[model samples]
Target: MTITIIGTGFVGVVSSAVFASFGNVVYGLDVDEVKVRSLSEGKVPFFEPELEELVGKSLSKGNLRFTTSYEEAVSQSEIVIIAVGTPSAADGTADLKYVKAATESLAPYLQEKTIVAIKSTVPPGTNRQVEEIISKHTDKEVSVVSLPEFLREGVAVSDTLHADRVVIGATQEWAIEKLLDLHEPLDGERVVMRPESAQMSKYAANAYLAMRITFINQIADLCEKTGADILEVIDGIGFDKRIGRHYWYPGLGYGGSCFPKDVKELAAVSKKLGDENNILVLMDHINEARIPVKLNDFGEKIGGWEGKQVSVLGLSFKPNTTDMREAPSLKVIPYLQEKNAIIKAYDPKAMDEAKKVWPSLFYANDVNEALDQAEVVIVLVEWDEFANLDLGRMKDGGWLIDTRQMYDKKSVESQQLQYLGIGTV
Candidate 1:
């Protein structure tokens, strides 16, 4: 099957790479020529494990190509997958301007009986709008199928190729069959449903995960007051078969490309349709408050931050991706800055990306450099390398605020560092 994926962002890139690796010819289209050219040179635009090798193999085997032209993209493939971004609007509604524009652009080029699968995360009823837009622009029978992507950012390649399940949504039976057939290369159970339901399923999945993260964080907050270990608390309840052990660890609340936006969007959509979304609204509220709450606790621990040389380890929202969207460090760093703390920060990959938001940051070369001469250290993101950081390098009696709870309490206390963490004694 020849496939053309529009909007070569993380979702699009992973799908293109995976589909191409399945021996299907994939044409990844994007308006960014530089990014497309970079991929052509075997350089992945984002940080994802095992993607570079797959993309290289796909290119070497002539199964994958990238271009900036919609005409070329539509001409090369029978199926066009929309993987455009749906960023949040000011009112928390999903901004679908990009999705509409992408669909309109390819309408003229779509051949008869083409399947237009929406891999982008969109609100309900978007598939109908896509169908109307494309059908109005051309007489070609364009099947707008809602095939929302469930790939997590860190493990997007595996999530796509080896997904536990695949949802196919379309109004027509032919569209459903075409999608299921195309996804045969992927190892997953096919879930067939209407477009709106499929769209809701994607939002529901993210919203539920976001809720779990928020719930854990809230529990951590309560646990601290009761002198309870949050980790053990999680272990006690997480072992229950009904409640799985994923997304249960409380950290700098859920921040990445999907959870935050999708949760807000789900609530936004519900409210827009004249329904109450108290749970989702509260989930968003709680996740947003995590950083500020942590900052308040950090300040309370140190008494004041007027002259404290603070070091923040891990600048990215999460590890492995250069994505800093909704990163807790973004909120935490600035909050500390407002409190008059001298800040030094470091991340393995996201330092460059982080610099855009925090240009005033005293960028550190490494974990040791960041910790040097620091009176306080805050582990904002849970980077694996930070788990083994030498706390002995820190000044004696300095503060160690482990927001993600990445370090051992006893080890830090033994080194004369005042250990501070969420929901811990």
Candidate 2:
């Protein structure tokens, strides 16, 4: 299968590499000359585990290439996958200008019976809109299929190759069969559905996960007030197979490239459809308020935030990725700054990206450097290195505000430090 993936962003690059590694010839197309050139040289623009290696191997195998020209990439392809970013518009709807542009650009170059798979996360009727856009530009029989991606940023390569499910949303039998055959090597369940359902599936999945996080965070708040431990409560509820234990993490709320944007879009969609009162809207509101609320609580526990040397551990949203899109650190760092706290931040891989968003803040060379002479420490993202931090490096009687609940309270106390975790008595 010869494939052309439009967009050189996270999803496009990963899809290109994975598909090419499966023996499909893939061309990664992007408008940015520098990014296309970088990718052609086997360089990934962002930090994702094992992605550069996979791209390098696929390039070496002569099955993967990168280009700036749509004609060069899309003309000879059997499947054109649009994995462009559908960033949130001002009205909270998905901005589909990129999707529409990609469809228009590729329409003229699409071969007869080509499968145009949309791997970008979009609203329910977006596939139909893209199909209409394609119809306006070309007369060729191109089948637009809603092939929504479920790749988590940090482990995108693994997720692409071994996804939990591969959805093929198309009306044409031939289009469905061709897409299924293209994804035959991947180890995931095949879900065949309508385009709208496929699009909604991606939104619904993210919204449900966001709601779960919101639910847990709300419970954590209650636990803190009632002197109940959230960990024990989670353990107690996890035994019931219906509720499940996974994704019940109590933290500074859910923040990433997908959840925040998807939830907002879903809420906007619901509001536009006359469903003004919905959980989606409330979930987003609570998630947005989590950082400030938690920070205030931490401030009260630590005797206020003024004139303190605060060491912030972890900057990225979660871990193993340098992406800071909608990360909790975005909210956490600024709030501390406004409170007149001297900030010393450190992350394993996100310092560079974090510096871009927060250049005024002091970035530590390492964790030890960040902890040096620190009066208070705040754990934002749950990176692996933070799991076993040496609490003794901080000032004695300093506060450890564990927003991610990464550190044990007893362990911090052993080091003569006051430990504060979410949902813990």
Candidate 3:
């Protein structure tokens, strides 16, 4: 299969590499010339585990390439995948300007009977809108299929190659068969559905995951007030076959590239469709308030936030990636700054990215540097290195605010240090 993937972002690059590694010829197309050039040199713009190696290997095999010209990439491709970013607008709707533009640009160069698959996270009717946009520009018979992606950052390469399900949403039989054939090398259950259902599946999956995180956080809050341990409660219920134990961590709520924006988009769409009291709206509201609320409670626990020397570990939303979209550290750091707390922050992979957002922040060289002389130490992201941090490096009586529940309370207490964890009593 010869494939052209538009947008050299996270999804596009990963897809291109994975597909090409499986012997498919892939061309990664992007309007950003600098990014296209970087990718052409086998350099990934952001941090995703094992992505660079995969891209390098695919390039070496001469199966993967990157380019800025649609005519160069799209004209010779059998499947043109639109993997562009659909960022959120003010009203929480997916802004599809990029998807529309890509469709328009590729339409003129699309070969007859070519399949245009959409891998962007978008609203239900977005595939139809893209189909209409392409129709206006070309008379060629191009089938637009809703091929929503479910790749999680930090493990996108693995996810793409071993997805749980590959959805092919198209009315045309030939289009569906062509997409299935293209994805035949991947490991996943093939699901054929309407375009709208496929689009909604992406939003629904993210929203459900977001809801689970919010539900656990809400339970954690209740546990804290009632002197109950959230870990024990989770264990008690998680053992049930009906309720699995995955994604049940009680933390500073859910934050990443997908969950927050997807929930907001769903809530906005539901409200506009007359379901004003949707639970998704409440879930998003609570998540938005989670960091500040937890921070205030922690401040009260450790005397006050004023004049406190705070050390923060981890800056990315989660581990194994440098993406900081809606990360809890984004809220945690700024809130501490406003409260006049002197701060030193450290992360293995995200410090450089974090520095872009907060240049004046005192970024430590390592864990020891950040923890040294700190009055309060907070673990925002659960990176592997933070799991066994030396508590004795901090001030003897300093507080350890474990938002991710990464440490045992007794262990910190043994070091003559105070420990504060969510939903722990």
What is the per-residue lDDT of model 1 for residues 1-425, given as tens digits with 9 covering 90 to 100?
Answer: 88899998888888899989888889999989899999988898778888889999999999899988899889767899999899999999899999999998988889888999998999888988898999788987778889988888777788888898999888788888888888888888899989889999999999988888888888888888898999999889978989966667687788888888999998887787777758998788878877877777778868988779999887777877788888878788888889999989888888888888878778998888888768999888778888888887888899898988788889889898899888788
lDDT (10s digit) by residue, model 3, range 256-308: 99999999999999999999888999998999988888999999999999999
Better of 1 and 2 by lDDT: 2
**Lowest lDDT 10-mer window, candidate 2?**
384-393
Q: Which candidate is the best by lDDT?
A: 3
lDDT of 2 by residue, 283-327 (tens): 988888888988998899888999999999999887999999998
TM-score of 1: 0.97
How far residue 99's Cα lies from its native spot in candidate 2, in Å, is 0.6
TM-score of 2: 0.98
RMSD of each: 1.4, 0.9, 0.9
Task: Give the Å error, residue 406, model 2.
Answer: 1.8
TM-scores for all candidates: the values are: 0.97, 0.98, 0.99
**Model 1: CA > 4 A from native:** none
Each model's C-alpha lDDT? Answer: 0.86, 0.90, 0.91
